[model samples]
Target: MSLRRGAAHGAAWNFATAVGERSIGFAVLAILVRHITLADVGLIAIASALSEIGRMITTGGSGEQVVASPGDRTVEAGAFWAQFILAAAIAGLLFVAAPVLARAYGAPALSWVTRVLSVNIILGTFLVVPSARLVQNFGFRALSLMSLGSTILGGTVALALVFSGRGLDALIAQRIVGITFYAAAASITARWYPPAFPSLAAIGRALRFNIPMMGAAFVDYVAATGYVVLIGIRMPVAAVGEFRIAQRLAEVLRELTVFPASKVFLPVFVAVRDDPDRRFAVARSLVDVLAIGSLAAAAVAGAVAKPVVVLMFGVRWASSAPVFAALSLIVPAAAVYAFVNPMLTALRRPVLVSVFAAINAASTALAAWFAAPEGLLILAWTLAARGLLTAILLLPALSIGIGRPAWPLLRLFTAPFIALIAARVAAAALVPVLVQQSGLGIVAMFSQLAVGGIIAASVFLGTLALLAPRRIGTLLGQLTSAFRRVPVVAEPVG
Candidate 1:
């Protein structure tokens, strides 16, 4: 298939996967909240955070290296063995350190929870090779089906356990079951067995390529999960739960808007790796499109965060609304960063990407530490600020990668940013009027949110259409062409 057609297919499947997975996850979480206490969720959050670090260490950019490399069975096998060994080691270390973590947090239950969740590190090792092969071949349809099935099975098991009063164990069980299913599905779909003799040279090459990438991944882990760790350490366990839920809601918007496209772009960039001009053009175009969509979605989500949180998680989580709203600003920054990072990586600039990620991680860690004492809202704001700082730090690399001045990129985003601001302002005004007119029952609150969202969307699109008419027209044209079933041509091999 042509690069365009391949990308479209991959994006469609990824979107389906993300939507189904997130929907099932939300349902499970909503149900679990009803059965579990905030402290329970917080405990799981701490365990999950630590496990994420181990996961980063285990995967350590090997999957991306595998995906970008040529179809070499030796390299694939080497990557598999490397990942498996590292994952096992990490799992063992996590198991041994679980009690120390529990002691640090003064939560005895965390020790066992951490130990149980550590199993995912090993499970993830089984998934890396096959999953990377699928992505390399653009086999997103199979991947999507696997993801959806795993999500459904996991959600079902989680709900059953919750009802059976398994408490936090239910969450751990859900993840373990989900990863197991995914590993099984990936193995079947790829249908490739590991070679008995993995090449040491291939392993060396992969490790060399991955060392810088792993540094970036580790930094990313700190940026993404460090806040939860800090909160768990310095604040009440309930506060960590609230912050985690808020972060999850904000991330949902990101998953829906930017993640699917980024997933598609990675392989596309790999295909066009040899052509700098083409790579730059593709990166710039994706940045423009993702920025417009992601920021607008973020604005709408932030505007209606209160009603959405209450509606999804019930009135008990009302306090989480502001946290969600504050964190929503991270969406646009995240979208741009996601687009830029893969483009850079595909162009063999992992070290540059690592530098940017390091700066982001360090800045965000400091911000989170300072903000933790103030409360969740301030911490949420800190997260937003971290996103902004990341974007700023990334500007130079983005300009170089795209072969354009940073100003043009900044200019491209101005319309969307302004539109988002105007939308929020409009929503801020409209929501109060609606609330005053109708009492704040569930129905009224939803109505107010609906009206506010409608107003915000209208303002955002109207402003975009007025300010960037050609860009809007181009997007529409692409959509029209996509629906018309254009002929597929094979992508140029790098």
Candidate 2:
């Protein structure tokens, strides 16, 4: 299959997977929130935050290597065993340290929660190579189906457990079941098995490539979840829960937009790594689409956060609304920022990626610390500010990687930023009127969100169309044409 066609198929499947999984996951969360208390939610958040380090270590850079070098059975075998060992080690470490982490957070429940969730690291080890093989072969359809099925089944189980009042244990069970299903499905779909042993040389090479990537991933993990840890330490557990929910909602927007794009585009970029002009063009198009889509989603999500939170989690979670709103501003910045790792990795610049990750980690830690005392809202705002700064920090590197000036790359953000501003204005003017007209029930909240979202979206899109008619037209035409083409499945790149 042609690269364009392959990309289209991959993107389509990734989008489907993201939409399906997130939808089911969100439903499960909404239900769980009704059953779980603020402290229960907060405890889970702390557990997740602590487990993220292990998760990062287990699956970090290994999959990228597999995807990038699919022909190397030796490397794949090496990565498989290496990751399995690492995952087991990390799980053990987490088990041993759970008490310490629990003590640090002053939440005794966190010890067991972290220990239970730690098992997922071992499951994640089984996932890395199979998933990479699927992506390498452009087997997105199978991957998407597996993801959707696993999410639905696990979500069902989670809902049942939550209804039975399992609380944090329910969340832990949901994660384990979902990942176990995905790993099993991926292994079956890939039709590959690990060898008895991997060559030392192959393991060395894999480790060399993966270790820095792991470093970057580890620091990036810290950057992403450090605030939650700090909040758990310095603030109340309920505050951590609120921040976590807000982050989750904002991340759902991202998962639906930028996350899938990142997954799709990374392999695509790696495939075309040798073709500079093509790579740059593809990167530019991706940036344009993500910028517009994520900003639009963020704007609408920010505007409707209050009503949505109230409706989804009831009035008790209403406190998370402003945090969600604050984090929404980071969406566009994150969209732009997503390209950095993929593009640099494609160029075989792990060192540069690591540097960027370090910078981001330091900045995020500092920002979170500075804002921790102020409250969740301020911490969230700081997160948004740090996102923008991270994006700015990445521009010079992106310009260097893509062979484009920083100015044009910066210009790509202008339309979306302007459109977001307009959307916010429209929402501000429309929301109060809708609230007054509809009163304050669930139905009213839904009506207000629906109407307000539509108006805001229309304004944003209309403004963008006016500002960049030609670009929008070209993008639409490309998308339409891509959709019409017959998908061609290809063998994994060797």
Candidate 3:
């Protein structure tokens, strides 16, 4: 198959998988919130955040090394052993530091929660080789389906446990079950077994990649989770939970709308690295689709957040509406950074990526420190606004990666962004007028939704069409062609 076709297939499966996984996650979270206290959620959020930091550290180290390395030696063997060892070390550290973490958070229960979830670190490494090989081979369909299946099983177990009064255990159970199932299924699908003999040379090469990658990963982790850490410092546990939920919802939307291309783009970029025209075409495609899709998601989220919150999370979470809306509105800006990071990776530019990530991390930390003192809602909006403010800074980085000007990429997002702003303003003003009950009941929720959602959808579409009809046509044609000539690959996992 041609490289572009493979990328398209990869992107489609990635979108499908992201949609399915985040949907299940949202549903489970909504249900869990009903059964648990805000404090409970907050406690788990801290523990989960720490676990995520560990996962991110390990993720940057070995599995991705296997994906990035084009090998003469058995890089997979080295990567497998590298990740397994790293996972073990992180797990042990988490276990040992659980008490200190609990003390820092002033929650004794956090110790056990961290310890329980630490097992996931060890369990996660088991799939390193299988998952990497699938991604390296453009087997997104299989990988996507596999992840979706694991999510379904995990969500089912979580629901059952939540109903059975598992509380914090229920949340922890979901990750463990999902990782276990995904690892086992991925290994089976890929039919990959670790070698009995180790390769010292392969290990050295993998480490060469991993060392820089790990630095980038650490910065990436700080940028991603610094808010959680900094906010937790000044806020109560309940406030932290509320903030985490709003951020989580926006992040899920981001994965669906902004980042489906990220998973597909790294290898795609590498494949076309030597061909400037093809690589630029891929980059342009990313800018167009990611910006438009993200803007659309943002518009809807901003307009319908109230009614969606009412329906899924009840009036208890009404505060999250504005926060979610604020975070949602910044998707287009966030897309620029997301799109550039992978391109840099493909160009073997980890140091540059790491430097940008450092900038992102420092900015996030400062933003959180300033905002957390005011209120959670203010902090959410601050985070959202900074996304747009700092996004422009990435254009130079992209220009460097493509060895071309970044002005044209901005044009692709401009029309959609303008349309989004107008539609959102219209939707925001209309919702309050149409919904008299103030989103307290199902009838009122639907009323707000009907006015806001319809206005947002219609205005955004009509305005985008009016402004960029030809570009829309071209983008649609490209997307449609992607679904054609897709080859079936058995024994693949998304």
Candidate 4:
């Protein structure tokens, strides 16, 4: 129908997809954890992380080229095939290398697991074009539903496999099956097919756009993976297991809350590519929503970090509560960087974005070197530095391009910090009271949740309402309008 309608549908689908996918992953993980040791889990983490890094590197800049290139259905489909072939070839190599990589990491047991999980990379190549199309065209509704269906199917299969006592193999199988089904569903839903004559010329053109984007991607990979690498090198495998779980939980919250909005904003940038004023307005609104929502989640995470970890993963994971709390601070800070990155891309500022990313990468490495001795605390310092550096680097671009924020963007920091402090106080007060109870205490569970929820809600909402009423009103109106829009696609995918 309209751009807004497409965005609304896309947002709805993204949220549904996230919930479904993450639920399946969590379920599969919990079941697998029963049979596998922490060291096994650590290997799984390394494998998955490596797989992601592989995909990012091989595909490189195709994601940006999808937007930058102007092409008809034939050219687009051909380009998609070429990229898919490239990605599949790369994934195949990694699949074979999985064993070698595992041996190097001193976790040879992970070899098969890595190989099985590598199938996802191949499947991802096929889906990327359609996924980008759905997002580029604001077809979130279809995207989300396909994702949900894939997740449910994947989850059911994994649960059945777990029940059959296949252990980590089942988890690996779950990923392959889920990604395959997800891509098939996405292709059907988006009504896209690869053209027969895949173009070398198109590939070359796309590479011109994507190579720089690849550099940016590499920086991100290094920044993110550095933690996993550092943790594996410096800490016990069991400690890595704890940090991984904590990172997973924090990431789940982030993907659901932040990523959906970022996806919607990308198309917004595309639509208003030439109008700096409108682009800035859209960017500001997106940032405000992200900042406020992220703060609220971080507050709850900080407040209930102890109980949440204990309830979800068991007392063995109690240490993750603080680790998670440290990582939670990075979410809102990362949101600002996330918001601006897409805006820069839409405005043909990928090089500038790369520069900021490089700075983040260097800072992350330095932070890791210093804090590596302390486990999660090192990660915390790294994230804190990232948030600061991201904001500083973006300021010149923001001031010169996007209008100055209604409030200093840094002012958004107050709510999360305040919420974190308040939540920690609440946690310190309530944790001792509830955690002392006997086996399987629902009283403790609900009380911790209730107290945490109230404190987090009060602090996050009160701070935002008082500090930025205009931004709040704009967000409420946007959400309301988004709900009212129909979910039909107005433009052709081809």
- lDDT string for model 3 (1-494, tens) is 78778888788888988988888878888898999888888887888878877876676756566677755237788777666777799999999999998888788998999999888878777777788788888988899998998888888998999899987778888888999999998998988766655767776766677766766676676666535866776788888888777778888888888667878878887888888876776788778888788898898888988788778887898888888888786677678878666778878877777778777777877888899889977888888878877777778888877778987887778888899999999997877776677527898888888888899989998999998877677677777777677533221110
Candidate 1 residues 1-494, lDDT tens each?
77777887788788888988898889889889988899998989889888878888778677888888769787787777777777898899999999998999989999999999998988887787888899988899998899889888988989988898897878988889998999999988999666675678877777777778878887887876655887788898888888888988987888888888888877998888788777766666667778788888988988888888887888888899999999999887778678666777888888887888788778878888888889888888888977876787778877766666766665677788889988989898878876665543698668868887898899899988888777776655554555456743222211
lDDT of 2 by residue, 1-494 (tens): 77777777778788878987887788889989888888888898878777777888667789888888868888899888888888888899999999998888889988889999888888888888988998888888988899898898888888888778777778888888998999999998899776678778777887888888888888877776645776688788877888889988887888887877677777888887888887777777777778788888988888788888888888888889889988888887678768878888888888888888888788888888778789989889988988888888878778867877755666788887898889988898987876665545787788778887888898889988888766676666666666666643221111
RMSD of each: 3.1, 3.7, 4.2, 4.9
lDDT, each prediction: 0.81, 0.81, 0.79, 0.67
The all-Cα superposition gives candidate 4 an RMSD in Å to the true structure of 4.9
* Residue 237 error, candidate 2, Å: 0.9
lDDT of 1 at 152: 88
Please give each candidate's TM-score.
0.95, 0.95, 0.94, 0.87
Sliding window of 10 residues with minimal summed lDDT for model 4 = 485-494
Q: How do the residues 20-94 of candidate 4 rate in per-residue lDDT, one tens digit apiece? A: 777776766666666666776677777777777666665555655565544456446545665677678877898
What candidate 4 gets wrong by more than 4 Å, as runs, is: 68-71, 74-78, 92-100, 224-226, 381-385, 397-420, 423-442, 469-471, 484-494
Instruction: List candidate 3 stretches off by more than 4 Å.
Output: 70-73, 197-201, 485-494
lDDT of 1: 0.81
Superposed by TM-score, candidate 3 places the C-alpha of residue 297 at a distance from the truth, in angstroms, of: 0.8
Query: How well does model 3 score by local distance difference test?
Result: 0.79
